[model samples]
Target: MPQHHTLYAAFADRIDAVLTALEHEGVLPPGTPRGNVSVEPPRDPAHGDLATNAAMVLAKPAATNPRALAGKIVGHLEKDPLIAGAEIAGPGFINLRLAPGNWTNELHAIAEMGADYGKSGMGEGRRVNIEYVSANPTGPMHMGHCRGAVVGDALASLLEYAGHEVVREYYVNDAGGQVDTLARSAHLRYREALGEDVGAIPEGYYPGDYLVPVGKAAAEEFGDRFQAAPEAEWLPIFRAFAVERMMDMIRADLKLLGIEHDVFSSEAALQAAGKPEAAEAWLRAHDLVYDGVLEAPKGKEPPEDWEPTQLPLFRSTRFGDDQDRPIRKSDGKWTYFGADLAYHMQKAEGADELIDIWGADHAGTVKRIKAAVAALSEGEGKAIPFDVKLVQMVQLLRDGEPAKMSKRSGNFVTIADMVEEVGKDVVRFSMLTRKPEAQMDFDFAKVVEESKDNPVFYVQYAHARISSILRKGAEEGFAPSADNLGLLGEDDMALVKRAAQFPREVEMAARTREPHRIAFYLADLAGDLHAFWNLGNADTQKRFIVAQDAALTGARLFLAARIGQVIRNGLALLGVEAVEEL
Candidate 1:
């Protein structure tokens, strides 16, 4: 109903209006492309409240110099009552200063929206299938899977807030060699459960104690029916049972970190339904697949036994991969990539877009999978936007040294161990404080520290302080009131300006598919709130509550409440709680 509720969007519309007016007057040619024009907050606050490059972007098309074009645009901008001033900077950048009342109006909007303050509708309700944390069902979730899980789950929530119909999915890799090993591992434990005196875990099987429960459950169900049987007679039954138990364990581990997937598509089911065969036949029909021999593996010392072998290869090289990839192995089983291609095809059937959050270790496979999706899009005659986000590994530490592994997993630290040590909030927030592609350290000591250096603590502390101030105000016979918002001053507006960036940040992060941006923005917002609160210590009159001035206190209180609301909304997107107290 409103032109725009957020300050940045409203100003963007205003700038577009100025451009349209210039075109009508013939100063700028009609139909000049404005796609590159941008309206955003200046990098340096000293420049102005908002800055735009409309003139520079339009100058060449309009056959005019940027500065001359900028002057005309500023003339139209300055006529708007909401714009206090419009200045032409170096080149053709136009900087705009909004009237104080505009900031006051935004603060009111924040209050009116509450939890929905930064919510966006830019996604236009397009269905998005995001497959994340699809860890193999061979073992419990360890720290190795932690980063992708957090990044993917947070990105899912971020997209939902930006108004997309998001389907959170997990692709269960049960039809694989890894699950075969898990079956053997569970079989050994089952033997021990039936009092067979099973020796030390053999070299190639999982050794985690977590499998003991699965083995016990199996022994109870079948009562040693498959024990001492041939590998063929028992492998399938054991694999099915072990994978189911492992998935249940994975689900519980994810719940500890506040994550749940809407769909768990099984690779075994895909193969049973011959989806991979369908994909291969379709590819063959389109000449996207052929019988080819892959060159020997490339390396300083190629395997001496390596030889060219004919296989069914997908034309991944045509789509930017280094070489055509084999879809089936010499043993006649589908390769992981082949199964994955079919899985993505299945996902694309229900969604407008596809996204996968994978670990950096899987970076080598990115190009081929992207190529497969592109090929599928070509055959389908419709463009399906696809993205693969890689999250680097997180190094765990205790007090500055590498943390120890979990005894239960007997391999690496599990997500449950990390969440139990610190908290879900700390684990989720700390994982997000840095960009996912960059390496990060999750020191148990530093994450739980009560210092400003810890982002989660700092942001949560800001929310807690606001809660305390509001409670104290209530006890002192006062409450936040917008009746005297006009009494607010420049220092107050500065905080409001920082709070106002949430909506813009939301859209930018969603567009880039980077949920970590939300975490970075929240840290900066919290820092601003902290600095504003510290002002009270040096000057009592600057405090949120002025004992002698009720109206001013109410206005400041109102500002504080809205700022807290924004912090809560951001933390929710990150899957972290906003604690009311430290």
Candidate 2:
């Protein structure tokens, strides 16, 4: 086994050793900051296998010209057995082509590592708490919450693969006014179940028929005990019952899309524990909170009767927010920001880092919550890493027109509807085919189209094709073997190079906190495999099962098998299945 598992990582270490040698020989100055140096594949593959900007980055610090420095670096790099060719490009970039055997070794690594080929240890086992798809417990999961749910779940998986302890969380908003409205709605359905005419749902109540079941359950358990009770008497009991039922529906919908959370923190519980009161006292003691009058709202016409009231405000302006934010209203009730701050504080207690996946509509509140985290952590003499990722809305469409809303949800298409129509794999993969911050159109006609244009189908088809080839090769008495891999040609090595990039892609995607990159990388890898497969159409000799030469057939099957392994690994990270048959 090599010191570094991936080809690129191995070469990066080799470049570092060369720089250290140069420093020892006094050719380059010692203690020069090498943080800016980078080793990666050239933008143009024609340049070489690997390119490094070490000389370009260190030339000024070494007090020499970039090209001159590059020559010295190349002189040291060319001596290694792995370097088939090392040359200086136009200015100072050093491009080195590895011996074909190095890529062959990577293919062998894939076989040995199997499903663990692309897994990394970069996170060092740090705990990460990720809260995503925390839709209010007032309704079932809808298309509006689908993208963020997938992104967050995939990100949690990605971080785990990169060696982090991840806690998948959903913050239940059962303490809000929405749940109160849910109780009232469930009460109406309860009355209807009790043989009373409730008429049409009122203007402010939830009209979805999904609540009818909850109402029936209430009617069954209580048996008209609260049928004629006062609003105050049954509000609390019904609120808890309705919220629990809604959460059950939400969980079932998420399961259809293969998402599950590890934690379900409640806002009401946090308040019950006096977390907000403690947070407020801490902020006040540190002078981060004080009673102040709020200014007029921005970007709006001021009302003639608008009045400012003094309230306890957090000094968010000190941390770059536009204005100081009130933590509590004049009536002494905690505001939403106050509760959220305390919730984050609770989250920070258990993890080294915190990430919240929020809808784009919450963009306005990101800064304040971040500021609160900053204040709280900095006040404690240590700052915890915090990030808020805003996922934009997903527009559902059938064909080219807007899709119809589900009558069950009464507002938008439900997650269950999407999953049932297109299948879970299609829904998960389609949600991740684009960047989360950009608006996406989930066109039902386009996602399930069995063609190269559909990324999910194209990637899955590549795996299936490789599986078919391997099965036929076995039937023809040709088994995958690495003994004859040296016979592989340039076209075969091209596919090998693409498959070897999986480890690098995993590390990069985890570092950037962007799971969509895995989707994009798999699409490219699948394209490469399909291109290689099409070569047999031009010439029969290019096919994998060459009965005349069993060695060549076995070697080609080995390459195909490894390519399939890499595809399976990438798809697993995206929570998509690599089907053996299309």
Candidate 3:
């Protein structure tokens, strides 16, 4: 169902074999509804190449003991050319160990596919919008935004690799009151850039020194242009200059982290037809526009005589939201929710699915946004398919000391700054080493430790070690060659089997919306490579780069080359760097 592929076909064949034998022997009653079986490697290597709990699942309906059923299934499987050994393990588990060289065939497949080794087309050409790092344009991105940025970017890459049409988007929060404050702040900097020292920041305005650059640019572009003008005349010009500078800074920040956006949708631009009129009209057409009254703030009080005011509200409660939401304020101004609604609606028009990467604070907002989209679709099949993921806060430390910051331009640490402090590969890989929802603590010392504690290094080492073998083999006159992989030993075959499962691992990551799965799988694959390497350290003849016997050395080097390719391909999917040498 998730796109026909060769490996899945092999799995399907194994399932069918079990089902047919069961039916033929009448252990399974006719029309027993045999489907949904799966084949995966055993948790322990001793169990087998692949393990299926098929017998235990089938035993109840077949009216037979699980072990008995497993025996019968194994009997049928042993005769299959691909199945070298089928053993009935504890509790009716049929552990299928593939034939010799069958596992090695995976190496050849990896070699054949090269960079495309684990790529899959599971999304079936569907369109998806991945909105990420929607950090307010008022400032640079902080370490807090890094996880979501990497996750969203890697997820977009994963989806695109799996045949989804993905739009990498940035929702520029340029229309809000925040920008007004930014304009005022830039005005002060405009004066400062003109040799005026406006010390200390005003309470509600931005305080980063980065804004000084914007003010400098403003003075350069508008020397005495708006000094004597009204707030209205200077606000827009300052606002535009400030936002453009902030965006340029943000873009540089993203590039430093190796993250880039395909589209930047400006919130202010969404108000082309005027936010108040456009949003109200859209809400009115759906009967969602209504009068709304303000409640005295729960903990804070409104001014006395702040009589209940009536205004337009979006009836978001109609579509799974917890409560009706206001879209307009008493002063005939749009609420933050108004521009947000329009922006998502813009996304709905082109995307078959909508995915947003947000921080945990916006968890409550997801339902309302989805509610708006559902209400807009009128509950049709065209209903927006949306999913919002929250990235938990990250704690940064250096050599056991808290990594402290002093307002590094913009309010917090930028993604660019973090990547600059630590390389992009570690930043990309480590962000995903933990589950997205789980709180992650990034340590400067541990990240560059060069031990197994550093996952990026471990994985990169596996690739480089493989390359080292190829270098030694080439020096020994071994022409790169691979043949009769079936002659490979059990340990050699196990590595090949893991290579074959890469696509399945990719699909699992995409389906679960868990990029961490790839991280976990690559780590395990690296472990396997390391295990094989250690075996060579213990047994000289098994060493991949043997100076004696060039033919066997070539064969072993080919296997090492295959591992290197897979590691490179896997890292590329996660947007992590793959270094061939340490």
Candidate 4:
């Protein structure tokens, strides 16, 4: 059996062929534009199993009215046994009802595919590098960083399932001033660890007590050897030591949310390798950078000493940025954008596409980075796709009130704290319930509540209920097998149609680079399952396991099993568990 049915794709292709035949018969123009043609499940099931606006889309170009063209298309489609009924709807739409055996056959096909059911070849194994949650190596990951982490991870999984070669990467900001602050903070903690009473943490440094352990670890390793050294001598040493420990803490915190990156690219390492300098030289040779002075801002107040000075700058304006961006500071250090450009340059060499997930605060940075990427890829003689998805802030709340800050993570709540409070599953699921760009409140009360209003619980309960039906079927000797699938009726067939949409949902989510759609799709699927199960409660004969009718019960069980399988498949892409019992 094929790994994916793609019934919609198959019918769409057949429709195109029919259109070509219609053209051959001289019924319409020879070459009609088929690009806008779409075959999708009807919004209202009463319309038909599937609907198409092909005639409406092509009618104007073909110089014919929609209903007339739809009639011709329906006439051709009705001749096929696969299409049981094809009728013209309002305007030019053609609604198609497939043979009942098609649904039963698809149910068997889905069961046969198992875990591989929804896997699509849409990505064609193209290399996609996804960089996300590159939080600074300064302290524990806070709640502010949670959304990007979950979104990135889920997007990576979604892409992988869609048949892309995906890389989950973290860009460590260890070369920046943040790590410098972390180093100094750890140095003070080191002093406190070595019998010296370090007073309250310095105002400019990290005040979180989480650094105490790092200071103790540094003292244990070096044994006060650098306690009396000058700041110059110990700053780099402590910076390197502290950055590593901070990353370890970050990784552990991410683990609490079930996130791990395949690569952790270090900004310091990129700088040390002279990658920024190399990128600068390349851009200069290509006339993409020059030593220039930038003008003062027009809309906003400029700095007090806003006089222009000669500095290396990238021609970001060439690719739609508001102004050319400076690549180097007055003190000759590469700016963050400079290093970021180098990093993206290196990524562009191997990756066919690059996706970055950043906090919404960095929204202004998107244009320049995209310009840099466009310039780099333009120089390469090929267009490399690059997108930056900004994840908005997540507000932590308890019982509709703002949650208390975590002392362990300083001023904000930690990812670990959230995970510990709810669970890895709840945290991940809640993060995706909304789009990454929209701010949301992660209410502690709403998430863990066992109610249909809670999407995570609702979806999970559907899977558990399906499992219950199957278990009861097994106990009553009505075990669901693909054998009696033809016995399924209108309700069973409707459920199968919903289940068949899994592959389409995966492809759609992957194409949009939005894993949240998977969550949305699963919720809808769960609702359908719940509604179907409720039907059984209204009529005992509709129950999954009938005490006397083993064959009918087995067919119903078959439908239930496929529903559960598709749910499990969707949840897998979202990195959520499909519980057998809630």
After superposition, the stretches of candidate 2 with alpha carbons farther than 4 Å from their true spots are: 1-4
Ranking by lDDT: 1, 2, 4, 3
TM-score, structure 2 vs. true:
0.98
TM-scores vs. true structure, each candidate: 0.98, 0.98, 0.91, 0.97
lDDT of 4 by residue, 140-180 (tens): 99988989999999999999988899989999988988888
Q: What overall lDDT, based on C-alpha atoms, would model 1 receive against the true structure?
A: 0.92
lDDT of 1 by residue, 1-582 (tens): 122357887888888888899989998889887888888999999999999999888989888999999999999988999999999999889999999999999998998888888888888669999999999998889999998999999999999989898999999999998999999999999998998998899998999999999989999999979888999999999999999999999999999999999999999999999999999999999999999998777665668887778999999989888889999998899999999999888888888999999999999999999888888876898789999999999998999899999899988999999989898999999999999999999899999999999998999999999999999999999999999999988888999999999999999999999999999999999999999899999999899999999999999999999999999999999999999988
Tens digits of per-residue lDDT for model 3 on 1-582? 233264645766777766876788787887776674667778897887788888888788888899998888888888888877889888888887776656566777777788877777778769999999988888777888889999999999888877788999999888778899999999998988888777888888888887878888888999967765789889987888888988998888888777889999988888875644765676687688777764555566777877777767788778776567887677766677777887877788888888999998888888887777777655334877788898898888888788867466645556767787778998999999999889988998899888976788899899888887777776767766875454456677667777777888888888877888888889989999999888988897777766766666777778878888888878988898788688
**Which prediction has more favorable TM-score, 3 or 4?**
4
* Number of clashes recorded per candidate: 0, 0, 1, 0
Candidate 1 TM-score versus the reference:
0.98
Which candidate would rank higher by TM-score, 1 or 4? 1
lDDT of 2 by residue, 78-97 (tens): 89999999999988999999
What is each predicted model's overall lDDT from 0 to 1? Answer: 0.92, 0.91, 0.80, 0.89
Per-residue lDDT value at 354 in model 1? 96
